[model samples]
Target: MTANEMTGGEALAHMLLAHEAGPIFGMGGFQLLPFYDAARRLGLQHHLINDERCGAFAADAYAKVTGRVGLCDATLGPGATNLVTALVESLNAGIPIVALVGNTHRLHSWKNMTQESRQVEILRPAVKEIIRIDHIERIPELIRRAFVVATTGRPGPVVVDIPEDIAHATYPFDETWFEVDSTYTAAPALRTRPAAENLAAAVELLVEAERPIMLCGGGVHISGAAQMITRFAEAINMPVAHTMSGKGSIACTSALNAGIFGRYDRIANRLIDESDVLLVVGCKLGEIATKRYTLPEPGKKIIHLDIVAEEIGRTVIPSVSLWSDAREGIADLLEVLPQDELKERLAKWAATVATRMQQWRVDVAPRLTSAEVPINMARLLHELNLNLP
Candidate 1:
């Protein structure tokens, strides 16, 4: 064989390394043994998981934490089926993952072969896209496509099903085919800002409103917009609230931070009730975030910004919807906002949030210090908070 020629498994491993795809999580099986051997030989980091579901979940967590595309794999049949729950979780949370699933040989497909099942059909609904590899030569190209699809736009899991025969099949490979696009290596591969007209309209509402608050969600974390959001909130003197998943969008100690707003919150709901205009960024304002769709009261003007257009009006219709990445949208708003004109008018709202936050801390102080035998949940949380870096 020529130096450019390699098996499907070797191509997959080589492409993964070229793209700098990190830490693969999976449980090995016969159908994927060649790829596993290739990975081992290539010095790729493979984390052996106890179950396929756990592997998928670990990948999901890796994506969430690193703001990169997570990688996982499973063999045919039961192994592939086990990843559904975690794939659904990643889909709903907008996390990026690339799942490699092994399948039976093409000849045995639909012939009642052992561990033979229609995995693409089974996993379609659970992922953003699913591609089955029929030709060994397309392995590297398809792997690159999977990364692009998984990380770009509204990030989610993509499945690439490789048949056993394809994995072991040798083919003439071009060295140029191994080139990967570095842009799609991480989540939020592209950043987009809102329209100029939408930002102007949102600014008008924000300037005139006596009470305006911001609500953020997981999109803030995905876009790595924490510092930008904090700066924006501070500049406008606006109170900021978060969903359960959106916690830590802003520093907890920041006076503008109103804490979690949802089914179980501290002071954010109170602020939301009093707000006249709501600036929602990144969050979907789903049932949990909106307290079963009963938040911001009625007739409150809303300005919604999200990377996904479909999520903008799915729950609560916004007066202005900015379909853009979380960081870029907020950066554009900050750039155009008339900050000098509105400091006096919004300072009172900021003061009110700070006062309420202090009062809430006082009210919860006793509970946090409780020394009950079973150890109160609040006390446990307080201890954890103290130790957090």
Candidate 2:
């Protein structure tokens, strides 16, 4: 292939390789042969899976594990449709993936094509964007845009359909088209810190409360603020309870760990009910986490910290809302706190929560033996606690 006369297939393969694409998972057919040949020439490793659906799933798994755009390919019609289920999963799970599908040639396009339908329209709803390439020259631009859309705000999948005629057509490789600016990074706006007066009011509530519990959520993991959470909890000696996804936000083995808070454990439910104050950090207070917002009595105070202000007071109205990065908010609160008083209160609360947890375990122990298989809640909790940090 001459430098200025590279085939569309070669250009597509080069662009994907430029992005450092690895082991593309997909099923192959005659329509996609040119693209596969190009990939082989470019030394881009191909992961040939048994079915197109599995290929899409493997691609989703790859993206989730590597934090990069996953790649999958399929031939026209049925092959493309087979990937729909896995593509939907990737979309819901917020994974970045690229689906490349082959299409009938331009000359044969409208003549009752055997393996051709409106592939782009069918996939439009399930992906970030869809680019149907009828011309060879548009391949580079389309590929670049696909990556941009797939990995951006609330990342999901994108689709690129290459007509067989276009794939075989020759075009000059445009190096500049694939060069993305290094400094362009996706950074969502962090939440702003609470005002001094608001902070003071929240602190007052915590200081006066006989039982105060700290609840952590997925945002802690997303913000990489687990250590900050641990620091804040330790500084106050407060009992730490995590939502299922936030299990590792604080070391589960820590003496201050009060176990998961939600419908999962009776002790957790009791702790939420009895606590005078709740410090909700990075948790959205979603229905799954709060059991449809069946919270404690109306008089209890709640201090909620989250990156998005709307998430605060979502399920239950919070007494104080700190719209800020969870890590930064916790750090700021620690700075302004009466450390001695907070520590004393935390120690007392931890002891109380721990005792309640032990009693809960004892109470649930009998329920396990009621069944022939035994519903081992304690064992499950133990296993979960062991797996968590």
Please name the candidate that would achieve the greatest lDDT relative to the true structure.
1
lDDT of each: 0.90, 0.77
What is the Cα root-mean-square deviation between model 2 and the actual structure?
Answer: 5.0
lDDT per residue, candidate 1, 90-179, as tens digits?
999999999989999888788898877778899999999998899888888899999999998889999999999988888889888888
Top of the candidates by TM-score: 1
Question: Compared to the true structure, candidate 1 yields what TM-score?
Answer: 0.96
Predicted structure 2, TM vs. truth? 0.73
Candidate 2 CA-lDDT value: 0.77
TM-score per candidate, in order? 0.96, 0.73
Runs with alpha carbons beyond 4 Å of true place in candidate 1:
1-3, 387-389
Question: Clashing pairs in model 2?
Answer: none
Deviation of model 2 at 67, angstroms: 2.8
Candidate 1, clashing residue pairs?
A: none
